[model samples]
Target: MNAPTMKTELMDAIKYDEPFRAHAIYYAIQQGYVQIDDPYNGLPADMDYDAIKKMQHANILQMCTVKIFTIPFGQGMHAIYLANCENDARAKHFTLYRQHAQRIQNASRRMDVSLYCEETGTHEVIRETKRRAAEFPWYVGVVGW
Candidate 1:
């Protein structure tokens, strides 16, 4: 019923009624009494880098945290949503906009945008709309806030 009892019974069975030399070979392999043929290939069998920079990228998905997204809805009103990521926040913002933006005053004015901004002085804000997943990222965020 337990490990020791099972091990004892197995050892007794192997010792008393084993067919030919199979018992000896099994025990030799189990107890490391025989030498095994092995060749070392130029590949990693475990995590290659133990450091932060070399850590696997997919492993960081578990490190994701709740992010606060403050997005403008309609008519000078701001909506806040606590989400896991930006996409989720965007989805919630869209749902709320559909429910409330139409009844608000001057809802269309919220869509107005100026390509030029005074914050950075000369540089304009560039917005990328396309979603890309195939290529490696060009930059990495080292700043932890």
Candidate 2:
């Protein structure tokens, strides 16, 4: 969608508490803001303090939208799955990962976004890999498109 139209829709969606609008807000920030160099961190920075504040506000708005739309469903699914996997450690890990996945899904409201990162499997494979690597350290590999 065009920038103005997308911004208007995003503002309206934010008013109604729609999480998917975070994607639009993200796009708007990327489109309208300037990136600057950070002096201390030696990294790219945001020179416009006002724009940064606006972006942060948009992010908070998106988070609120996610809380409103997805928290209940996320809690329900977490409860159900955790109950089902009550005794199995691996299953518990999977369940926690599922919860994290739900949070990411809630944040982005996109199944594709949820699937994009290996980090989304935080409580399961990612945690397991770290846990097992204390002595017999090894890398867990992932291939993504």
lDDT of 2 by residue, 67-119 (tens): 10122233233221111122332243344445432231121222122122355
lDDT of each: 0.32, 0.35
| TM-scores, one per candidate | 0.25, 0.21
Off by over 4 Å in 1: 1-50, 53-61, 73-77, 99-145
Q: What global local distance difference test value does model 2 have? A: 0.35
lDDT at 47 for candidate 2? 47
Error of 1 at 124 (Å): 35
Give the alpha carbon lDDT tens digit for every residue of 1-145 in model 1.
4333323433443433322222333333344444223121221223223332222233232321333344554455445444545565556555655543222111112121222324444422111100111321111111111
